[model samples]
Target: MPCDFLPAQRALLDATEHLIYTGGIHATGVDAIVRKSGIARKTLYRHYPTKEALVEAALRRRDDRWMAWFIAATSGYTDPRARLLSCFDALREWFASDGFHGCAFLNAAGEIGPATHPIRAVSRLHKRRLFEYVCTLTRETGLAQPDEIAEEFLVLIDGAISLALVFGDTHGADAAARSAQRLLRHIPVSS
Candidate 1:
């Protein structure tokens, strides 16, 4: 409840985040995270009472840091359309990294069968915020029926992630951009 984690705990959480995202929650154990982080087992347990707590912390930590990476990836884009494309590009970079798993939200959703799981709730909220942000961007772009445009982007993004994971190729990210461009063809844009 201290909000700020001590250095060792932070280190443990950071390592756990990478492990969980790269491998999985159940697949990665406390000892592995501790070893990977070079932190003591007692210290790890001191910060995280249970693996579930550690998993939650890992998810929150990853999400908190990801938005910054995403923002930077789209920072120079002059158009909202390009910003959206850049957003998926960031995802592609992540997916094609040396050790990539799939989407954290999607992964958590699969691990969590119980509706009451905190991680599941957080995943849902995270995804909802993403959709809302996409919709807001569509609105700001002066596009018609912005909500519909956002929904299309949502589908395209999800499909892209799925394909990228399915084929272990980054081309899905490029394909997703194309799919978005095609979807946007119906609406006319003013210069």
Candidate 2:
């Protein structure tokens, strides 16, 4: 992973992210990134020695940006349980967004075959962060078995993303949110 990026490198990363998000990691070639970034091939190589390196960096960038966006989106609700439920609301909004192409990490994972692949590691890291955040929310809400609840929430979130992608609609989020509500109904919310 790059500790820092030069202006040219930033351009390359941005272009690579856009291309990979819109297209797939394997489908977006180095030439495409260079063309989209308007950066020279030599400059790109200088910044990233290999395509895998560039892909990993782009995924890292997406993970940071996406997580920040999600946190901000869900931060508006004050109640702990509301905050937990806000995740699904945020997902619905994202699903309806113009640039939404499903979870970038999930998409990348499918494209990167090997479990040992660096891109796969990036994908796993993204999910782990998401799960941790959900766990924090569940704990704050005074939910019993925070780990289990968080795991369930993560599953619903991922399932909603996958369904939204497959159906080309926001109903998946709605369904997931409803299911989540039912799941939480049995758990006592902290006052």
Give the number of the best model, judged by TM-score: 2
As a TM-score, model 2 comes out at: 0.95
C-alpha positional error of residue 126 in candidate 2 after TM-score superposition, expressed in Å: 0.2
lDDT of 1: 0.79
Pairs with steric clashes in candidate 1: none
Superposition TM-score, candidate 1 onto the true structure: 0.86
Which candidate number has the best lDDT? 2
Off by over 4 Å in 1: 1-4, 188-191
Q: Model 2, which residues run further than 4 Å from truth?
A: 1-4, 188-191
How many clashes in each candidate?
0, 0
Tens-digit per-residue lDDT, 1-191, candidate 1: 24577889888888988888878777998889988999988887888888888888888777666655766766667787777667678778877887666678888878788978988987877677778878866776776788888888888877888888889989888898887778777786644
For candidate 2, the 10 contiguous residues with the lowest summed lDDT are: 1-10
